[model samples]
Target chain A: MGYHHIHRYRIAFVDCDPAQIVHFSNYFRWFDTASREFFTACGVPSWRDTERGSGLIGTPLVDAQASFRNPATYGEDIEIESWVDRWSGKSFVMRHVARRGDTVLAEGREVRVFAVRDSVDPPVIRAVAVPAGIRAMCGD
Target chain B: MGYHHIHRYRIAFVDCDPAQIVHFSNYFRWFDTASREFFTACGVPSWRDTERGSGLIGTPLVDAQASFRNPATYGEDIEIESWVDRWSGKSFVMRHVARRGDTVLAEGREVRVFAVRDSVDPPVIRAVAVPAGIRAMCGD
Candidate 1:
């Protein structure tokens, strides 16, 4: 378990689909944002800062999944609670639960890896091992 | 299995993140669009038409998942091949494969249900059975 963080967001009109409910894809975007917020809360620096210092661009997702339990409409406020559920040598799993009031709207899981720009002409990215100091900051 | 459809898209500048690669979340959106395209290719009427006739809103996701295999960048053209992988009484699974030329970028699976607006104050949606006509049209 890692430090938990809650990210609050208002469902904008643009976030809703023609069906008048939040599109399922938006949850993944919110979960990704919440994951970054969790890292920031744990004293992890910005990717820009890390890139400057360690050549680490940012954590990128390798796999993602979400279960939608309830429908949410525009103008509703929602909260996503996020934390690192597991850490491996090269990747970590992030868990996020999105709620409106007392009802859980959705739950998301993402597998992400720290990455850097590979030395290729066409520009490629490669995953790197999870950094120990950053892991320590996020609570090993 | 159902009729397969390929949806093509060009990656936009706004689709990329600071990592200079397409954000993982965008893949889900593309997969979703491809699902709809698959239905359209099967001669299924639009949701608006269905709602007018059957009170059916649209297919809403119950579960969604994606695996990222390669990173893509802006200005690249990609194609998403989508089809129904499975169908049950109340829900169906959609599969999507995204590719850039010979490279497979990602694969996605979504479980979705046909739904209608429930008679609730704040607006609730409920899943309904898979319509036989739609299933036939989709080559179930």
Candidate 2:
């Protein structure tokens, strides 16, 4: 178990499809946002700040998965609870659950890596070892 | 194996993040669009027509997973190739591969089910058995 954070959102008209339910892709977006919020709640510095200090740009997703349970529509308010599920030497897993009222809407998991820009002229992203300090800040 | 369809898209500025790479969530969106294109290429009627004729509003996803192997940035032209991987009694699996030129960017899999609106006042979505005609049209 780890420290958890909840990110609240209101579904907008543009978030729904012709079927009048929230588009499935939006769940991934929400989970991503919730991950950021989780770090923020854990008192981690912004990615921009970390990038300047240690060349640690941000955590980039290597794998993502989601299971849709119930459908949501525009004008609905929902909350996503997120936390770190596990951490490895170079990557970590985050889990998120989305709900509207008492009904579960979706559950998501993401595997992300700490990344830095390579030294090439047109720099490419490369994964780096997970920094212990940042992990500690996440309160696992 | 099933009939395949390719959906090509040029990465947009807004599709990238501050890290200057395509946000992982966008890959799911592209994969989804490719699924619809796959159906179209297989000569299946549009979801609207199915809804009118057989109460089949659309194929909604129950589970989705993706693995990112490479990062893509704005202005890059990418193509997602999608096809049905398997079909069961009430659900089918769709597989998608996204590539930029010779480089593979991401691979995705989705489990989807045909859905119809329930008869409640505030109609809810419900999954139904795989429609034989639709499955045949998909050429699986």
Candidate 3:
């Protein structure tokens, strides 16, 4: 288990839909932000920096899933707790839990891969093995 | 099978990450929009209208997943083909394929349920069975 990182933000009007609740997709966006925050907390450089040094473009998600547990509206402050739950050779699973106080609003899990830009024209990305330094930094 | 609804849009700069590719989360957002477009093309009323008439708030996602096949950048015009892939008693799976020309950019699937506001304060939502009329209108 790696260290947990927390990212907090208030819901905005644009994050809600006609149903007057935060759009479910917004949770995935917040989760992505939280994943980056987690990497930052682990002392990993920004994707841009890594890209220049090692051709590591970014960690791109291969799969993401979320279960909505409660409805939250704009003006509500929420926080996402994120951490790397599992790590494989070429991919890892990042887990996120969104909450407002004690209520769990949603739970999400993302399987992501460290990718590099393989082709410039028409842009293509290819997954690479989990970098050893990154794994150590993340306490895996 | 329901009629496929096509939603086309140009990717904006804001939709990309530091890698200059559309962030993976944005695919979920577009799939969501495509889900509603599918309903509109099937002649289903807006969520607001359904809410007033039958206590239906909107279809809320319970699960969402996407597989990236290619990377796309800002200013690229892409279209998503969306349809209801499966309808169950209380939920349905919406599927989407995003493409530019014949190149597939991504594939997404979402499990969603028709929900109604079951409580006022602190807002709670509950899923309802698939509406027969709506299913028929969707050609499911």
Candidate 4:
């Protein structure tokens, strides 16, 4: 268990499908944003600054999953609570729960790794070991 | 195994992150569009038309997973090859393979169910049995 961060956003008309409910994919986008917010709350510097100093480009997902619980519509304000669930040598797992008022909307998990630009010609990126300094900041 | 449909799109600048690579969440969005295109190619009518006739709102994902293989930047053109992998009594699995030319970028799978608006006050949706007619159209 690590620091939990809550990200708040209002659903836009474009976030919904013709069915008038939020598209399932948008939950993933929100979860991704919430994950970054969790790191920001933990005092981890922005990837831009880290890249300039340590070649840490950003966290990229190797796997991501979400389970839809309830349907929500546009104009609804939602909150995604995110936290780091586990940390490995090379990757970490992020968990997020989205809610509108008291109703749970969706739950998501992401397996991500710190990465750097390894090649430019083919636009390749490679994962690096978890940064100990950032991990310490996260209190894990 | 059903009809395979390919959906093509260009990555926009907004689709990229500060790292200058296409955000992983965008892959889920493309897979979703590809799933709809798969049904369109199979001769199924749009969800709006179906809802008017048969109370079928749309297919909503219960679970979605994607594994990133390579990084793609903005302005890159990508294609997602999508198809139905399995059909159950009340749900089906959709698989997608995203590629940049000959290079494979990501692979995705979604577990989805046909749904209908079960409630309006709180906007609840419920999954229904897989329609045989739609299955037939999908050649399954």
Point out the higher-scoring one by lDDT: 1 or 4: 1
Query: lDDT (CA) for every model shown?
Result: 0.92, 0.92, 0.90, 0.90
Question: Alpha carbon lDDT of residue A113, candidate 1?
Answer: 96
TM-score (0 to 1) for chain A, all models?
A: 0.96, 0.96, 0.98, 0.97
lDDT of 3 by residue, B28-127 (tens): 9899888888898889999889999999988898888888887899989999999889999999999999998898999998989999998875567899
lDDT tens digits, residue span A1-140, model 3: 57899999999999987777888888988998999999999999999899999999889988888888888999999999999999999999999999999999999999999999898855788999999999999988
Q: Which residue ranges in model 1 land beyond 4 Å of their true spot?
A: none
Please give each candidate's TM-score.
0.97, 0.97, 0.93, 0.94
What DockQ class does candidate 2 belong to?
Answer: medium
Model 2 chain A — which ten-residue stretch has the worst lDDT?
A116-125
Clashing pairs in 3: none
**Residues forming the 10-long window of minimal summed lDDT in candidate 1 chain A:** A116-125
**How high is the lDDT of residue A64 in model 2?**
99
Q: Write the per-residue lDDT of candidate 4 for residues A1-140, one digit (tens) a residue.
A: 57889999999999987777898888988898898888899988888899889999889999999898888998899999998899999999999999999999999999999998897755678999999999999988
Among these predictions, the greatest TM-score belongs to: 1
Ranking by TM-score: 1, 2, 4, 3
lDDT of 4 by residue, B6-113 (tens): 999999989987777888888998898899898989989999899889999989999999999988987889999998999999999999999999999999999999
